[model samples]
Target: MAKTQVEYAVEGIVTRQMIEIGKKEGIDPQWVQKRVSEGRIVVPLNINRPCSVVGIGMGLTTKINASIGTSTDIADIDAEVEKAIAAEEAGADTLMELSVGGDLNKIRKEVLAAVSLPVGNVPLYQAFCEAKQKYGDPNKLDQEMLFDLIERQCEDGMSFMAIHCGINLYTIERLEKQGYRYGGLVSKGGASMVAWMKKN
Candidate 1:
């Protein structure tokens, strides 16, 4: 339990927690051990996270993630917090704070403090919004601004980040050649970048 997957596999000892959980689920303990030994399954137990449940991935029961947050037009932190609580009570495996409006830091911290489950976010949305407000040109957004926002989110205890790293300069060219469809890049980050590209 105190080591990586490779380290645990080398030991060849079935962890008691795995065995107990498998027994409760009516699964073979050895099968659980084998799956854990492989890298296919990840038990994301952050040292700071207080949740006791162990999540099983890859062929496990389907899980749902509920996204709750404030939009630029509807920047209500209290409402967003309430929505997050409601989502948790409604059985969401995880919550994502997709708040692009209001005090982003305050909203994220409030949600994290209110929930025991994992929290995720997309740092680029906050970055793009802030950049546009400060510089009047979204494309003028600096890499440092994005990195600082990510670091701030991590410091505020975000368990995961949805970064669009693959959509870089070259990818834009490819997308341009592909041309626009009805929706035209539904990704918020992609759309924001395209808007900035058009404006600049």
Candidate 2:
């Protein structure tokens, strides 16, 4: 298996990605490597996706992440690709393809191809959406299915993922005990996970 950036950093190897980010951030590559080894920095470039890299975390520039995706009512792949391009052109350091509608796999690949910015996604979005469509209830989302989807997305060259592994029974209990928040839970993936936890 190929080593991760963290693994390489721990071994004191200054990778090409670190050098590129160092050049871009106007910092020493060794400084970047030190921060990465200490887990204070991240360069989110997937080995499978050969894109321009960006370093995020302590001491680096505050990078902007632009989100583009297809909604249920507006699942236009071409439009989403255009949005990805526009985000890159407008100076976004990263991109999140959060599509929950209309051939999500294809949409992700197209967007990845459209921009050199590191691309990420919320795997739970696709898992919950597919479960809701297949079983008529997001609550019935299978654990194996979710894991498989995550692996597939990674294999498809998603540079990173916003996995909701933090949501569990304990979190649900805490939320229930705390009553209502200002906005409650506005996240679609978060709400789906809560609903699944509540039902199961």
Candidate 3:
């Protein structure tokens, strides 16, 4: 495994990507490195993808993440690529491909080629999507499938991902303890986790 951005920062190395990000954000490299090392900011850069890195979270200018991709019904690869460019032109700081249709690898390459911002993906979506295709149900998704998808995406140059591990039995206990019922939570990723846990 490679050292994370935080680890590199902690070792007092302001990576080239960090320097570029600092220059664009009008921040000094040392300040960016310090924040990255402290976990106050996160710069997701996959060694497989060569693009300008940027930071998110506290003490930085608000960054926009535009999610644009193809669906089963609307898998227009060209349109998706165009949308990626438009999002960057409109000042989106990041691009996440939630593509669940067509040739995903080709679409990813096209989108990455079309945009310069940091790129992210939800590997679980692909994992479950493939699982459903193979087993006729997403409920058949397993840990091996999930981890394989993650490794593949990382190798394919995904800068970041929204791993669905935050909600667990402990979270349920805490919610019950707090009597917290924030219903109608609109998180597709969270819902997927809950559904997977329920079935598994």
Candidate 4:
């Protein structure tokens, strides 16, 4: 597979796989080619994954994402992997492993190994969980741990990452000015940060 979408576009040859996929979606082959050429659609292909599917993003059908993982109370890697497989078999565009309790890296690797679909993750969750486990304070987590986790996930062949980079100092100040209410910042990462800040 090509390293970047641009590389895939400049090849000037439409892979048979892309044509067949376009036909299945009732889209013209040229349209698919053009979209790929423009980098509007992304087909995340992992070198280790043999089964690849074209996921149309713009002006395409709504795709489904299934999240499967374990929490601290029930950290069952086997069960989580099974669910992820089922989700893919049932036609999920992507699968995300949000394992917080168990070995996060192990769970992610096993999931990636189990499914051919694009795997996504929220690095902050793993970072916060690890920080709490190690230092008993989430705010104690610095940029190094966060960036390291992000890089590790990327190196692990994650197709995409859901990074909450928007929730920074400015966003917090805005929230504070607006008066933070119970369950205000519903995002898990945002709530975790707020709690950590309050405690620290």
Candidate 5:
């Protein structure tokens, strides 16, 4: 529906943001665009927000992502924004605010304003929470609702998302062999994905 960074880069558009990312990564802007087009690098950016583009994935230095969010038990908006501030000050490459409590939209906006770095989120949290509030369980979450929530976040300037789609039936079975450890299949994102086979 929209021309993404990959589309622009593949078409030979070296954006100002790409230039900045190249400077930071000590590579040429054209190289950055090439990798972006080739799907070798990722620079999650939302045009709604003003943030320096950060290169991630293949051939870049290992980046640090500071997760700052509230659990179901706690939902303090100010505290989350403060964490974003702390993350930026401490040299976090990106920040994922996974607030499942309080006014999520307000918290996201304030947090985005609180830091110049890229802001990310786990949209499934909102979708699952909504399903729980209405349908009585996270398992009842509708896919349409999930997509709607993701669109809202994009509109609100979310630069990235932690969508763990790598887990497939084969991976699940393999992990189950090891008991899946910790939360096992009932983990954060795995529990929702009972179907579907992803690429390897």
Candidate 6:
């Protein structure tokens, strides 16, 4: 297991990524390390992928994370890679591959290779998409499969992930208790999760 930035910071050590980000932010590397140790800053650089280092959190510049994805109707890896490169060229601080179609792993790899920006993703999208394709229903998603997908995505060098840790049974119960919700949920992953919860 590798030591995280926070762990290294706690030990009074500054990582090269911290120094690079510090230079970009015009702050001292020690200050960046201190903030990281204090949980006030995040440098989303995955060990498996070497790309530009970006800092997000308090006192840092606001980062624009551009999302590039493919739906079932239009799953084009080449186009998604172009979008990833375009986002980077357009000064995006970070990029997220949210493709739910085609070979997701291949698409992610191509997108990651397309630019120097740190890349992220929503693991649930792949998990749900795979489940739906395999079983003809997203509701048939297996718990183990979801966990495995998360691990695989991490291994694939996703610097960040949009994991829905807040939408659990307790939240669902409160949602049902409230009743008459306006504007319903707009997130596909969220909607599928709620449906799965209701069924199970």
Error of 1 at 126 (Å): 1.0
State which candidate, 4 or 5, has the greater lDDT: 5
Most TM-score-accurate candidate? 2
Model 2 ranges off by over 4 Å: none
Model 4: per-residue lDDT, tens digit, 80-146? 8999989989988888788888888999998998988888888888999888888897678877998
Candidate 6 C-alpha lDDT tens digits along 1-200: 89988899999999998899889999999999999999999988888988888899988999998989998899999899889988998999999888988999899888887898989888888998888889999789899999999888888888888887669999888888999889877787788788988887
lDDT of each: 0.73, 0.90, 0.84, 0.77, 0.82, 0.88
lDDT of 1 by residue, 8-87 (tens): 64467666656664675577766666777776554443334444344456555656788988987999888988988898
Give a tens-digit lDDT track for model 2, residues 14-101.
9988999899999999999999999999988777888878899999999999998999899999999999999999999999999988
lDDT (Cα, tens digit) per residue for candidate 3, span 1-200:
77888899999999887888788888898999998888898997877777767889777889899999888898899999999999999988899999998888788888988877889988877887888888999879989988987888878788889887878977765665787476843677677777787777
Q: Write the per-residue lDDT of candidate 5 for residues 124-157, one digit (tens) a residue.
A: 7787788788888776777788899898999889
Q: What is the lDDT of residue 181 in candidate 2?
A: 92
Model 6 error, position 36 (Å):
1.1
Worst 10 residues of 2 by lDDT: 188-197
Off by over 4 Å in 3: 173-182
Runs of candidate 4 with Cα error greater than 4 angstroms are: 6-21, 33-40, 46-51, 180-183, 193-200
lDDT of 1 at 28: 74
Backbone atom clashes (below 3 Å) for every candidate: 0, 0, 0, 0, 0, 0
The number of the candidate with the highest lDDT is: 2
Model 2: how far residue 89 lies from native, Å: 1.0
Q: Scored by Cα lDDT, where does model 3 land?
A: 0.84
TM-score of model 5 relative to the true fold?
0.86
Better of 5 and 6 by TM-score: 6
RMSD, each candidate, Å?
Answer: 4.0, 1.1, 2.3, 3.3, 3.7, 1.4
lDDT, ranked from best to worst? 2, 6, 3, 5, 4, 1
